[model samples]
Target: MTCQLRVLGCSGGIGGDNRTTAFLLNQNILIDAGTGVADLQLHELRAIDHVFLTHAHLDHIACLPLLLDAVVGARTAPVYVHATEQTIQLLRSHIFNWLIWPDFTVIPSAERPSLIFVPHELGQVEQMGELSVTPLPAIHTVPAVSFLLSSKASSVVFSGDTIGGTDFWQVVNQVASLKALIIETAFADKEHAIADAAKHLCPSTLAKELKEWQGTAEVLITHLKPGESEVTIREVLELDHIHPIRRLLQGEIIEF
Candidate 1:
């Protein structure tokens, strides 16, 4: 198995070359179908067999419909989409409800539909190909969860948009082989109130969160707002002594 991960995008918002969040794992499984998925070539799109979504937010799931539409009949099997049941409801009620897009789950017929929904729960672990995926706790405005992607060599936890909490760090500290912690710090100190109200992290809270972690995973910051990227990253840089934190860039490849 090819134990590799490619970061397609990690921006908080779009415009001027920024794409939202998406990650391709082993070229066959996508962690999130954000706008970044648009960068994949045709063949690459067809190769995706599974997509695990962290939540149903637009930036995180913007390309899911387009992706399903792109690979409808070209592949032999349905593309399984994993998410929490609440997220599934959001997608069904808002996105695939025929008004917005075709419900591919039963489109060509239920027997051979193009997309499948797999409802997951916190602490649930799924073995997809050679990797083990688990949902971890996260506190977001809407219900959301982080993910732990593990291969035999190492593990990487991706914290989808969230306000760091004790429950989040509790699960993270248990992963003995964690190689990297790909997290979100969407705002800077200047936007702390906005961040708090939105249930997102800024540099200040990120530091408090780090104090609860008990692992050696390299911290890779993600989801910085376009205009605040520099400020947010600089604030995060001040916490390097806590956990080797750095900014995660689009198109970067992380291998384990």
Candidate 2:
């Protein structure tokens, strides 16, 4: 089996030409629901059966309501939303609230909701068909989580949106079977103070973070703030202990 990942959105915020963060795993498992989801083909839109939300940030989940609106009428099975209890509550009370967006849960029928929220505790793994996903806590403003997805042949982790931390690095080091790590680097080294204030990682901090991790897995960077991509990549290029440190470009596909 082939495990594919498509970058839907990779920037920190939306500009007239930039998109926020989102990614698709195996075409069926969506990592986030940023503005890029609007690019999905109608048929592709209808095929998404599961969404693994990292948090309730507007930039991370801004497009979910729209995506659900696009496909709710066509899905045979209810879309499963896997997230932390706190994150789910935020979505329910804020984004999906009847005031902001239509509560899709009651759209088709309340008895059998079209969208099912499955709260996942950090550190526990959930099996979804052929994919196994484990939610890991991420250091961010809200109750965010990163993920470790494994199939029979390969496994990788997606760091939703966070600064460098010991917990995620420790978990990655122990995952002997880890093949890749898609982490977020939102700012350049020059913006260290800004990055810190925003609870995001720049290349300088990311280099320090990587120094503490033990492994040679592919280090794929994502969530680069628009217009600062070049500087962030330059800073990453200066790091040691690993090679093939590639930036996660929007619309790019990765097979693990």
Candidate 3:
């Protein structure tokens, strides 16, 4: 079977056509349930069988509730949401509560509800259909994880919103057949204070983090803050790195 990873959104925040982080693996899997999912047609939404969230941040899971509401009746099985235990709880306590949104896990009936939370630990290689997904270490304000998605032929790692850590780079360094690294640099050098406070990355810190990566995969930067794209992009280019760096764009496709 052919394997494809499509970028539905990679922006730090939303405006105009820019959207928060989200990716589609083949047709049935989603990397995150961001606002970008709003663009998917009904048939496309119904095809989603699994959603892997990096964190419980609003930007990363903005569309999950709506996604379940849109596709619940169209499919026979509930959509599985895989994440760290903390993330799952936050989703339940904050986003999925009856006040904020009807808890889909009990919506129709608990026996055959529309959503299921599957908590996974770091480094667990979970199988979802044809792909093998492993969670990598991450340092963000809330509990978070980066994901390594591997098909038999090639692999890809997404460095969800984080201040890159030594363990993260160490694990990714050992991944073979890694084709791409979709990492984030969420702010400009001047706003690095904000980045550091939020545990996200800026060009300067991102450059420092890249030194730990000893992989050959092309680096695609994601999550640049809305109005500062031009300055951030320029700053990112001047950084020293072993691998080629490119800006991840919405609707971009990487076929491996």
* Candidate 3 TM-score to native: 0.98
Off by over 4 Å in 3: none
Instruction: Write the residue-wise lDDT of candidate 3 on 93-162 in tens digits.
Output: 9989998999999978999899999999999999866788899999999999999999888899999999
Which window of ten consecutive residues has the lowest lDDT sum in model 2?
239-248
For model 1, the stretches where C-alpha displacement exceeds 4 angstroms are: none
Per-residue lDDT for 1-256 in model 2, tens only? 7678888888877776677888888878898889888788988888888898999998889888888888887886888888899999999999888899989888788877778898999889898778788987689877899998888778888888887588888887887677888899898888899989988888878888888788788888888888888888878888644756888778888776
**Cα deviation in Å at residue 54, candidate 1?**
0.6
CA lDDT of every candidate: 0.92, 0.84, 0.92
Lowest lDDT block of 10, candidate 3: 239-248
Clashing pairs in 3: none
Backbone clashes per model, in order?
0, 0, 0
